[model samples]
Target: MTTQEKRNLIKGLIFISPWIAGFLGFMLYPVVASFYYSLCEYNTLKPALFIGLWNYIDLLTDDIFWKSLWNTVYFALFALPLGQVVAIALAVLLNQRCVGRPIFRAIYFLPSLVPLVALAVIWLWIFNGEYGVLNHFLGWLRLKGPNWLGSTTWSKPALIIASLWTVGGAMIIYLASLQDVPRDLYESAELDGASGWHKFLYITLPLISPIIYFNVIIGVITTLQIFAVPYVMTGGGPARSTLFYTMYLYNNAFSFLRMGYASAMAWIMFVIILGATVIITRVSKSRVYYAGE
Candidate 1:
């Protein structure tokens, strides 16, 4: 409407232009292309040929698709809850006033900074049935350690365990949330002779419920897309027990040259994650507390 307003608007657009360009080139284009590709049969060597809903139809009858879905579901179910508990516990500990607090925080958080591939490689050795550190420790305790990665029954569980090493990132978020909880509430509770557990259960948990909701949504999304660690560590495993959805998608796209099929799977995963997040947000609506609420 005015020269100054127009200049300010232009300057604002200029400042965010990199992000806009990136969103178009990297995110938006891929999303659009993936949707189109999902409707076709593609091999990178040749152009995609449209095939309508055949990919979705085939996936419905596909055993591996179901198996991968189930495996992914199992991983997400266990990983999210366990990781949340561990992160919150760690956060609570770190929230305490103590000696070497910064050092302890750094030590706990360092694992999350390790590359997933590197972490997987390290855990691969750690979970070795024989002559590995974990087994050796079990042996010292006169306990037998099963073949973790080699066993179909245990492989997914092992991956879940390994991935928990990165719960430090979640811990940091929880710790920050913990700090924002009103100190006066705790002091008031103390005046009433409230025990530590009582204070935490009634006050701290309520205040940090929003963070829990945020982290749960994030965990659900992240765990659903779990690929790197299992891909590197178990190669989807001894009996395909760890054949995650993404791993199968990768196989279809690269291993089998079924790019269109992979695209379909990606879209399905997107829908599932989106639905789950929405459901979680809706379910958490009443429980998640903010200062004003």
Candidate 2:
């Protein structure tokens, strides 16, 4: 309304103009164009031809698309919850006053720092059917190991097991949250004759619930979009049991040149992620505890 205010606003906008330009050029434009292209038949080799909602309709009837979706959902159902439990359990253990605590924490976390491709490659060898370390150990107890990557029955499970190796990042987050819980609360619980399990359920969990909710929401998004490991390790092989939604989308976009179909799939995935996040938030409303709330 005033000259000084207008001048300040212009200066602020000028300072942020680079960021504004980057957002429009790199982020907003691509999203808008992707949505438009999703409604059309697009391949890099030719001009896009508008085809309305045919892409979406085709996706609905596509068997492979449904299979990929099912695989992704199946992976998420098992991976997300199990990852959370393992991470929380590790965090709780590491939070205790014990010898070699720092070393143990680092040992647990180092796996997550490995590159995804490298991690996949390493696990590929580890899960090898014959002459593999895992099978060698299993044989010591007279138990036979399944052909992990080769068997359709074991491929998804193998990927899931490989996924658990990278739970270190989540573990660190939970460990931090655990450390932030007031020590006096645990002491008071102990004075009340509360067992370790009781304290964990009643005191520790409630205090760290907000962090759990945060991790669960993040885990949902990440697990649903899992691509790199399965892509490198299984290559969606052994009857497509390990085929995930993102891998299928990648194939459509790059491998098959079905960009329009891929775009439609991407948008659908976006909706799924958004819906899952909203559902999680709604469900957490009664459960997640916030300090001083």
Candidate 3:
């Protein structure tokens, strides 16, 4: 390389050296160690005994693993799409020429700023079986509400409902992307005597597909790694209805002291997430449009 090119490369490396050091020191070692540990049977105090694919085989026969996977899949299936719809609808509404729009945006986004523990606490009360706001309101209308977290039938749905309260961060991103869209597209659609629905269909939807794709991928990743809310509230209770993948993994690792098994589970989760992300990103490329790409 030329002297100037070499100098530029050196400057870039110097700037990124901290990140490189951290990645190698922390992330890389743990990732490789986990894969190796997954093949062993270790309980922290005991020496790691290499057991080949036994851990993998055990997971195949494991009921809790499957149950937790199902719970997590259910969470992702409903939460991802529902949260997207709510965020998008709110974004579209906020995009309107309404009075106090800034205040409205702030109000909508405030919930996302609340700590996850606080959010879970508030939701616990909201979904409480008796003497709770939701149940009390239902009682006022002479309607009986189910014991949400206490009942297997309603626990997962209640958790999903609780998760929707923090769609504000995604909504903000979508709103910004919406604002970046070209106005001429809408103007031209109007000149064609297109109704609002028609304009949104032919103009807005196409333009915003990229942002939607972005949000969906993020939502999927976050939903899969979900641990805090269910951990705090249900403790994976009501017949394991809310026993999510991460919670199960946690139990295996710390509670059960199955470090090797937990490592295997973590690797499996990594593979599943990596595969899903790859598929989504590949599929989205055809549908998502960059404004001036």
Candidate 4:
């Protein structure tokens, strides 16, 4: 290369050097180290002793690990679809030309901006068995409310309900996608005697299908790693019904000093998230619609 070209390349590299260094130190190193630790018996107090798949083998027999996995999956199954539907519905309502539209949108989205721990604390009071706002309201209607955070049967459902409170973030994304749908398509469909349901099913849905797919992929990843709220509220109580995967992983790493085991769990979760994302992408290949061919 010419001297001028070499100088230009060096200048360009200098401009991006910080990003390259950060990626190597903060991202790449941790990932590579985690994999190595996963294969060893490591605690923070002692050196990592190479164990060659023993941690992974132990996980196969760990009953609590299996329980945590099941709890996470159950929560995801209900939380993901319900959150998507509610967010999309809210987006659609907000998209309409109505008075106080901005006010309503702001109200709906404010909850997502609240800190996760603070949100959990607020919900803890709301879900209390007696004298709680929810149960008090149910009392007036002669309907009894269960101990939400205490009952194994209802704990997961309670978390699912709380999960909906943060749907505002997804709703904002859906609203953006909804606004981009061409107005002429809806007008043309109306001219063809298409009803509201028909227009939504045949036109609106097809146009926003890509956004829906994007939300689904994100929902899968986040729901699988859910931890904070359950940790704060129930502490995985009432027979470990709320012992999610990440919470259990945290306990192993910190509480039990099983860093190697926790690392293995983390890698397993990584694989599961990757597989789920791939499956969703494959499924959406034929369903998701882009604006242009």
User: Quick one: best TM-score, which candidate?
Assistant: 2
lDDT of each: 0.94, 0.95, 0.93, 0.95
- Indicate the residue-level lDDT of 266 in model 4: 98
- Look at candidate 2 and give me any clashing residue pairs: none
* Decreasing lDDT order of the candidates: 4, 2, 1, 3
Against the hidden true structure, what lDDT does model 1 obtain? 0.94
Residue 183 error, candidate 1, Å: 1.4
Q: What is the lDDT, from 0 to 100, of the residue 160 in candidate 3?
A: 91
What's the TM for model 4?
0.97
Give one digit per residue, the lDDT tens place, for model 4 in 1-293.
99999999999999999999999999999999999999999997999999999999999999999999999999999999999999999999999999999999999999999999999999999999876788888888999999888788999999999999999999999999999998999999889999998988999899999999999999999999999999999999889999999999999999999999999999999999999999999988999999888
Q: Which stretches in model 1 have alpha-carbon errors above 4 Å?
A: 2-18
Stretch of 10 with least lDDT, candidate 1: 130-139
TM-score of each: 0.95, 0.98, 0.94, 0.97
Off by over 4 Å in 4: none
Candidate 1 vs candidate 3, TM-score winner: 1
Between candidates 2 and 3, the one scoring higher on TM-score is 2
**Candidate 1, residues 1-293: lDDT per residue as tens digits?**
89999999999999999999999999999999999999998887998899999999999999999999999999999999999999999999999999999999999999999998999999999999976698888888999999999999989899999979999999999999999998999999999999999999999999999999999999998999999999999898798999999999999999999999999999999999999989998999998888884
Ten contiguous residues minimizing lDDT sum, candidate 3: 197-206
